[model samples]
Target: MVTSTLDRASAYTAAAAVLDPEVPVLTIEDLGVLRAVQVAEDGSVDVTITPTYSGCPAMQTIADDVATALAEAGFGPVRVATVLAPAWSTDWMSEDGRRKLSEYGIAPPSPPSPTTGDRRNGPVQLTLGRRPELVACPQCGSTRTRELSRFGSTACKALWQCESCHEPFDHFKAI
Candidate 1:
């Protein structure tokens, strides 16, 4: 079936609405993983996404979800592409996504340092060189949180405990 630009926009919207497999509270668009959704005049859809981590296990699931969502939205023959050149950053996360994450009991990614500037928009920042940013506790909203472990319940998160609430929470590490 032939599709117009308006249809393409709708297809993009559909695909972008797909939620992250690991974190259901946030959509791919919210997580900034749904990079670009392009629709061809022939009604084919192409979705570009970037993984939070290169070895992220949910990448396949996210791709599948995107394809399924677009197909269900009446867009056919979807192709999902992954791009890692510019790398994914916590900075790419949307403000609404951050709020959703916080509401979901997961600390959202902190903003990139000013020095980093628009550097987050291009190239990749080495994790080893990155200083761990201070994280606020979702429960108590306390900035006085201590890292319990480098790894949390998920690969992308770190385990932290709030001094005020004394509650353990997952912090979405800034990358």
Candidate 2:
């Protein structure tokens, strides 16, 4: 069935509005997780999304939310598909998403290494193995922040505290 441009736009708007369960401040669009939206004349909609990481606990919730958003917007038979081929990276995150993260008191992820293309494939390194690079604290803008834990409230984030402000915050990890 041929899908009208209007239908496609509507479906995209609905799906894009769905927020990440882990980060309420940023919509899936902002996170760059909402990859594509296709709509049919019958109102069926298909959405393609990539998880922040494979096995990210929020994937299910994100899919469900996307389906719900489309259904609520009068788009039916919603199908949310996951793709892992081009593994998601912090580089996919929008500038607005990064700004929102900082505004929410969470340190935004640094840009992926330019030489490595973000290292989205092959063996994943779990350890820093060296002095962690300085991450400025979102609260005080202090570069003297220390990582409190490798994992934070979510797998995509790490716990950090500022030495200057003595405030604790989450730092979105660059993947």
Candidate 3:
């Protein structure tokens, strides 16, 4: 069975539709976790994914979901590979993903700050006390939000409350 370009694209479409277990509003592709998909001549499918973090608990479930989705779409022997090297970054999240997050009542991660100095050559600098990030309230769009906890419902999110709205919401932390 020779796989054509259409077969690979179909496989990718199937795999990319799998939703994140933690954030159901965003598809794996929208979250930037669905990295690559390839359909072999043998009719087997291969997928490569990068987790949001190294120890993310949702990776296995995500892998299974991708495999299942592809299998259901008539692709057999689906293989989902996890790659941690080059690490996943919040920068990879699609604009649509961020918009969906905001609509889902979770504040999307702020844009990553520009890197300064030569990170490769020098020792890492640690700031002991940093000011709290100014996170806008997803509900009220107010910047007067305070972080309630560093850890939220998940490792990737932080719990925060809006001073104006008095509503507590999860904020997707910038990686």
Candidate 4:
């Protein structure tokens, strides 16, 4: 009994459902990290992924997760490929992904600026009035928080300490 291409495609979809280990709330698809899935004529599955950040250690784990999921779905040979050309951007994050990140206690990236002038100045500068409020404490929703470190458990996040709750948490750095 051989599986049809459609069946394999369905399997690929299912296999890709596994969420990122670091941020369990978002699946690779939601993060726009899962670039492509190809099922060869011989039943081999190839999954292409672009990491959210270069040199991110989690990419290996994510690849392994993809391979494991495909194998469990009865794909005899699974190939996980990393593609780096286009580069991953927070802009690729989906709306659902943003909601999931916030629900998971991390902030999501803000929408991109409308003009290219926003980028020519090294990093975007926010006028005092236009500046966004400090990220609230994810555990308690308290606005009384201070940045403890620019880098958190991951490069994409920053460590913050809640003055009200006295707890340390990660804030997804606005890219």
TM-score of each: 0.93, 0.89, 0.89, 0.76
Query: Which one wins on TM-score?
Result: 1
Clash number by candidate, in order: 0, 0, 0, 0
Candidate 3 residue runs with Cα over 4 Å from true position: 112-131
Model 2 Cα RMSD, 1 decimal: 2.4
The superposed Cα distance between candidate 2 and the true structure at residue 8, in angstroms, equals 0.9
Candidate 1 per-residue C-alpha lDDT over 1-175 given as tens digits, one digit per residue, 9 for 90 to 100: 5667788789888988899888899998898887898888787888899999899999999999888998899888999999985788888889999999999999988766686655447876566564756789999899999988989988999999999989999999877
Clashing pairs in 1: none
Candidate 3: the clashing residue pairs are none
lDDT per residue for candidate 2 within 1-175, as digits (tens), equals 6778988998899999999999999999999898899887777888999988889889899999999988899889999999985778787788899999999999998766654455445543455464466799998799998999989999999999999999999999876
Model 1 lDDT at residue 34: 79
lDDT top scorer: 3
Question: TM-score of predicted model 1?
Answer: 0.93
At residue 124, give the lDDT of candidate 2: 39
Instruction: Find the 10 residues in a row with the least total lDDT in model 1.
Output: 124-133
- Give the per-residue lDDT of model 4 (tens digit) for 118-139: 3322543435443444677777
RMSD, each candidate, Å? Answer: 1.6, 2.4, 3.4, 5.1
Please give the TM-score that candidate 2 achieves against the real structure.
Answer: 0.89
In model 3, where is the ten-residue run with the lowest total lDDT?
A: 116-125
Q: How big is the positional error of residue 51 in model 1, measured in Å on the Cα after superposition?
A: 0.6
For TM-score, candidate 1 versus 3, the one ahead is 1
